[model samples]
Target: MRTAKFWMGTLLAGALALGYGCGSDANKDPTPQDVPQQQVPDAGADAGVVLTLTDAQIARVLQVANEGEVMLGQYAAPLATDQAVIDFNNQMVTEHTAVKQRLDALLAAEGITPEDSPLSLQLQAEVQQLMDVLQGPNAPAAGAALDLALLSAQLNAHARTAFIGDSLLTPQATNTALQQELASERQAVQTHINEASDLQSVIVLPPVEP
Candidate 1:
């Protein structure tokens, strides 16, 4: 069983190496390949989708999510020049780190060891795909391009985070404290989505003349 800390460390290190350790490609907009996302049922749909995830899996999902957000912020902060981007990155790092620590504490207190599930592994793969886009040949150059890349990724990530939390983790969590925490975190993810959208609007270049 890979520990959460080990998973976090491995992801962070690999993202750092991919985004910064390798020389960046300039004047190129990152176009990340489409990655598979969690499929949540629409409102008013039949309650047909059954999730068999355990509380331990829910814990892993929370841990993986917070860690991924932290890595995303940390990887992009140094490359960002815009003050708004910088501030957003800082906020992500701070908030996600705090939430992750709290989650760890809660799990420890409850003697719950996070066990990775298919959802958690898929989330990890999605993060890796995002990193590949940011670091690959078409990786954005520093400045507005980089800001756009980071903000776009953030928006999508937070949206997915909310979906998984609301549709899967929160519902599956049996612990009252864990459910409450997931609710709070989902709210935070929504805020992050709004912030990222605003930032993307600010940084995205206008359409080029034909």
Candidate 2:
């Protein structure tokens, strides 16, 4: 009975973790026949979306999001026409660069880069796996869709600023800075999703290039 109870508990923990990882709303990306997303227009121009990513958090955010964008573009090349790919490519570049710019401004104001170590490497490895699948033969459509959804949730949960910016407005020694930083990151994640959705629209041209 003890052994059985242990297994049951472990199973329950795993299930909860999986649910959280996939997102509370499994239906968030509903598309026809499980394709995950409806046809989105080719993202027209860089001006189409504006996200506020500060320079303080730019490097890490870039490291993660860029890898994700690259994986998405390469792995799912067949999903969108060439023009749509180009549009997505442009959007990714624009929004990510904007993140860099904002971070740069913040850095000049406050002289620090947040601590990042093995975490960045871990994320890079995951991106490379997705890339390999894309660049590899026999890559299935199902795998690509699953990877995109997983990465979307991961990025959404990550921090936006190197340090919370709210404390900065207070005194230099106050603890509230961390909270402000977290809030800023949360906001940045929302902006990223909106821009990504916008870019998804324009990729529906006939015979989307792989």
Indicate which candidate wins on lDDT. 1
Off by over 4 Å in 2: 1-79, 82-86, 140-182, 194-210
Tens-digit lDDT track of model 2 for 6-40: 12222223322332333333424434332221122
Q: Give the per-residue lDDT digits (tens) of candidate 1, residues 1-210.
A: 432222233333333332221222321233343121223223233234344677888899999999999998998788788898989988999999999999999999988899887668868877777776777766666767677777666655676677666656776789887888888898888777767665665455434679
lDDT for model 2: 0.38
Whole-model alpha-carbon lDDT for candidate 1: 0.68
TM-score, structure 1 vs. true? 0.73
Query: What TM-score does model 2 achieve against the real structure?
Result: 0.43
